[model samples]
Target: MYKYDNFDQTIVNERVEQFRGQTQRFLSGELSEEEYRPLRLMNGLYIQRHAPMLRVAIPYGLLSSKQMRMLAQIAREYDKNYAHFSTRQNLQYNWPDLERVPDILADLASVEMHAVQTSGNCIRNTTSDQFAGIAPDEIEDPRPYCEIIRQWSTFHPEFSYLPRKFKIAVSGATHDRAAVRVHDIGLYLVKNGQGETGFEVIVGGGLGRTPYIGPTIRSFLEKKDLLSYLEAILRVYNRYGRRDNIYKARIKILVNELGKEEFTKQVEEEWQHIKNSVLILDQKEIDRVKAYFTEPDYDQNAGDDTGFESALNENSAFTSWASRNLADHKVAGYKAVVVSLKAPGIAPGDATDAQMDFIADIADEYSHGEIVVTHDQNLVLPHVKQADLFTLWNKLSEQGLATPNIGLLTDMICCPGLDFCSLANAGSIPIAKQINEKFDDLDYLHDIGDIKIKMSGCMNACGHHHVGHIGILGVNKKGEEYYQLTLGGSAENDAALGDRLGPAFAKAEVANVIESLIQVYINNRDEDERFLDTYRRIGMEPFKEKVYENN
Candidate 1:
């Protein structure tokens, strides 16, 4: 976790003062609701269906136990007793008072967190694998770079107002848990053929009315030129990205209109003008940023714990949860634990105040007082000792945070649909619940392994449905809720957009349609093949044929 320097602290403090003034003006009627709306949105305050929603950024998904406790306190004192964690690795308070939002921002600044860039058409939160530092296959920790980008993009004068929102994701691991391919800009930290570390840059990727798989704009960019390269990409996008139509403003639409070659050429030409300048990497600045993320003092020989294996064999629930929720840690005898937010009937990503407190306590006790928010709407304790696995599981289960379904059908990624979002035409949380109930069986869900099921209320694709192994997009047709399905999509290393599975299904029929598609995959898959692999191998024809034929 990056500690705030004087400059960082000053900016946050100043922004709070700025927003406080904005709040005053809005409340005093200097700005109309229409006028105040965009200004407030830029500050991460949304006037939701019922009340104002305040989104607080958890940069690169990192949170200290102290910070987590502060969030818990905020939820308890200010708004509802719960907060919804978003796919962008942020937290949203769904019922904050409009007048008190400035105070909230002030409080967040105390803990080095704020709401800026969580909303509006600016560079949004940069995301990465929750297990970045501890992931076994990581090339390097991505957080330092993520933090650098976070600092650079925060209120960058030229990019604060873009044609549409911009999102960026980075991945240090071979596995793309960050969903990099579907973001506006995806940076894969890589080692080139010459053994120099750099980024494999992909551009023009997003999901909305139009879904696009980002094209590789740069095969490799030296690590030193990161900021300059990113500036080049954004410069090109801001200059040429469509603004005439709201429906087609995303970089994805621009990329589609101009093919990848032209897009790449434009970015390259832009980079040529900016590269090797003062904006290029400064070793001193890189060190200053990277210093905050130096590895914690971890025990060297924390070898395999036989006690954990014994516990696994004895408790079936614990074993199941461990299997799905635990990830391989780079350090021997340590594990990365996923605290699933999609437990049974609870709204996906809604963590009550008590749960946050519980997580804070657990991180303090089990991990090194650190926690991470995953883009999958889950929380991660990246360095839990293997010896303490059973204890942590029991504690989490007691707190309703231990759901043994990760990457399974029940672990759904959903947006705040019609229930809270003014933009949503249909409810996504209920749809997730409906599907969750339909596939509640632990064994069954585990058998239909590693499926990323995402849902969005509308085509804005906040839930990232376009990249789900089984994507569900909500639509309203003649006042009835309907869902369009897409299959074969993926967010991993070989990211690809899902093909449409066919016609939309009525809300009631969604579960059945999904089950039928899963059954088709089961029938066609080879030994131990995941849903995505099977979908890619056989294509959409088999699943599409089965799903629509029965209808």
Candidate 2:
């Protein structure tokens, strides 16, 4: 709920006009594709297999009702009436005319939104927990810091073109819902022994061809030095990170080659020079930014309603949906509801314009006119009264938006594979569909409980496959799609990369492989143990044996 000021509005307006001129020149053949690639990519436009894909940044996945309505309008007028939500909490339109991108940018600017830094080798979106303010376990709200980073990194001349794209995630919660450990820079907001809040900085974490969980370079970083320290890390990477090969260009790769101690030393040296610079945040400036994210007023008298309890007793369907979709909130008598985008038959995270509009309406009517896009390819109404649960469920169910499969197998994180992405080696959407339908039983899914199935069409890991409880990476083996499995991975506080299963399964065998793995879990799991807990306890051998028995 951060609002744009005159300075913010002016900057966006100027950037839109600048990009508009660049686009016109590219279309008029004044610049060749080679010359225009960087320009277009910096503006978040990608030439996909079928059409130009435009990614719009949703900063820290927060959006107002008015902004959500504008997105719905953009999808209807510019895209093919549907948009895809990405793992970075960004939205993508698969079919947008290149000529009208400026118009879309102009429309987005009006809403304090833009596509800036969504693509190319600069800093990408700064992600945080979707449950930032409402989560009971949170240390502090991370959105204000995320906003600070957004402003600092937006077209920062020093980091405009790094060796490769950079990612940063902030987690104010005890549990890491933001996948902080898998980002290039994971900032865990922490309180020291003195009860002074600062950051526990984890550097060089990323997933791709060479997956790495960045080591903690600093156990404690002062809150005032966040941006300065971040700049130091980037400066170190930019100065020494490989530019010789695109494969070795990421900061993770550099950290791996140089060893964590050396990397930490370099960053420390750089930080000493910049720690007291203009980037050093003051209490006044921090408070000013935090003011934009103040909590909404609520009725103190609003407690658990008897009507809601009655509805739960009477309607099994509502009960099931509520159990899966609703999350605990810090505020009593309030719930954070996740709106599933992974309904059966549709591509994961693809929401039609109508669906987006409906969500906006619901957000206004129930969630204080605010919405949140989760990093897990879902939308969230972060503040819903417990009394209005049944009514909200009815509205959501009517629109096919209430799937009740949050944290289940069907609620998987997936990328636009061969369906749209040119770099993809196989189709991920179809595989997700197969798994979704295979695990169609709600009772069975609820019984199994909290299985994260993340699939990527390639090693780019756009789907965040490496961090899923069950990670599936698509590969091409002699023109055939082969799915590789990895198990025991998680993006939580105790984050660890998954180990690869013995061999890759053919596209047809992927679902069967998943089923066999699940059966292994069912056989070995202790009572009430989740998929991840079972995997951790028994390791991957049992599942690997079950999966490759026929191979």
Candidate 3:
């Protein structure tokens, strides 16, 4: 984890005071709502249907145990007793009082976290793989680059106000766990034929009203030119991207209208001027950032533990949990354990104050005093010892944080729909509850295999429904909530938007519809194939027919 320097601390302190004044003025009627709107947004405060929601950025999803404890404190004192971890790997407080938000910001600044750039039409928080440095298949750690971008983009006067909000993601692993293809700017660390590492830069990929898998604007971008090239791309978009319509203002829309070839050409022309400028990253600076993410101390003698093996053999419940929740690590005798927040009746990404405090304690005792927030709304103890697996599992189970459904159907990505978000047409939490109740059987979920069910309350695509193996979208039909279904979408190496199944189902019928789709998969799937693989092989007709046959 990167610690804040004096300059960083000073800036944050100043901003908190600044926002405090702004918030007071707004309340005292010195500043009107219209005038305070952008100011509040710049500080990551949103006026939702019920209250002001405060979104705090967890840079690149990295957190120290100390920071985690602070988050727990904030949830306990400032907002409700729980916080929601979002799809963007950020945390949200849904019930914070408007007058006390500046106090919350001050508390966050003490822990070196902030809410800046979280809501505005400026560059948002840069996200990356939760398994960045520890993943066995990684070419290099992407966190350094992500941090570099965060430093460069935060409060950059040139990009302070774009036509629409922009998102950037980086991935260093062989598989794209960060969903880079769905971002405004996606960078993949790659090796050339000569063994030189660089970036494969992709632009214009986004999902909202329009969905696109961003095209590779540059086949290979040199390491030294990363910032310069990114600046060039942003410059191009800033100059030509639409400003007339909110829906058409995103860079994805611009890329679609201008065509990829023209967009690439313009970015290249813009790059030539800045490529050799001071923006070019040198080895010293790169090494400085890289130093912050160096591996934690490991016991070199750590090897296969007999106790761990024995425990797996003795307990079927632990075995099932391990199979789904644990990921392979680069180092032997260690694993990255995902602490699932999606329990049977809980909302997808929520953690209570007590749970956060306990997780902080566990991270200190087990995972090198660090924690990671996954894009799938789970917490991760990235460097857990294999020898302590059973003990850790038991502790997590006691906290109700040990759900063994990592990639299964119940472990779905869902947004705060009508319950919290005014933009939502339907209630996502209730629907999630219905689905959880309908598919409570762990054995049945295991039998069905990995199915990503992403739900969005509306078309903003906060749930990333477009890339789910099974996508559920909520729609308003004459004051009643109706759910639309899409199948075969994926956010992996082979990224694709899901195809829509015919008509929308009524709210009560959603669970039954999902069951019908699962049954169709069970009937036609080949041995060893996952839900996504079977859906791709069998296509949409079977699932669509099964759902709409009785309609």
Q: Report each candidate's C-alpha RMSD, comma-separated, in the order given.
A: 1.4, 0.9, 0.8
Model 2 score (lDDT): 0.92
Please list the residue runs of candidate 2 whose C-alpha ends up more than 4 Å from where it truly belongs after superposition. Answer: none
Query: Compared with the true structure, what per-residue lDDT tens digits does model 3 show for residues 26-76?
Result: 999999999999889988899999999999999999999999999999999
Worst 10 residues of 2 by lDDT: 298-307
Q: Mind giving the per-residue lDDT tens digits that candidate 2 earns over 280-378?
A: 989888899999988998767667467878999999999999999999989888999999998999999989999999999999999999999999999
* TM-scores for candidates 1 onward, in order: 0.97, 0.99, 0.99
User: lDDT of each structure?
Assistant: 0.90, 0.92, 0.93
TM-score of 3: 0.99
Cα lDDT for residue 308, candidate 2: 77
Report the lDDT tens digits of candidate 1 across residue range 1-551.
79987999999999999999988998999988888877898888988899999999999999999999999999998988999999999999999999898988888999988999898999998998898888889998899899989999999999988999999999998888898888899999999999878899998887888887788888898878999999998998899999999999999888878899998888889989999787798878788888888777777766657889999899888888988999999888899999999998998999999999999999999899999999889999988889999999989989988989987888999999999999997889989888988998889998988888999999888898988899999999999989999987887777777888888999999998989989998999898999999988888888888888865
Can you rank all candidates by lDDT, best first? Answer: 3, 2, 1
Task: Evaluate residue 409 in candidate 3 and report its C-alpha lDDT on the 0 to 100 scale.
Answer: 93
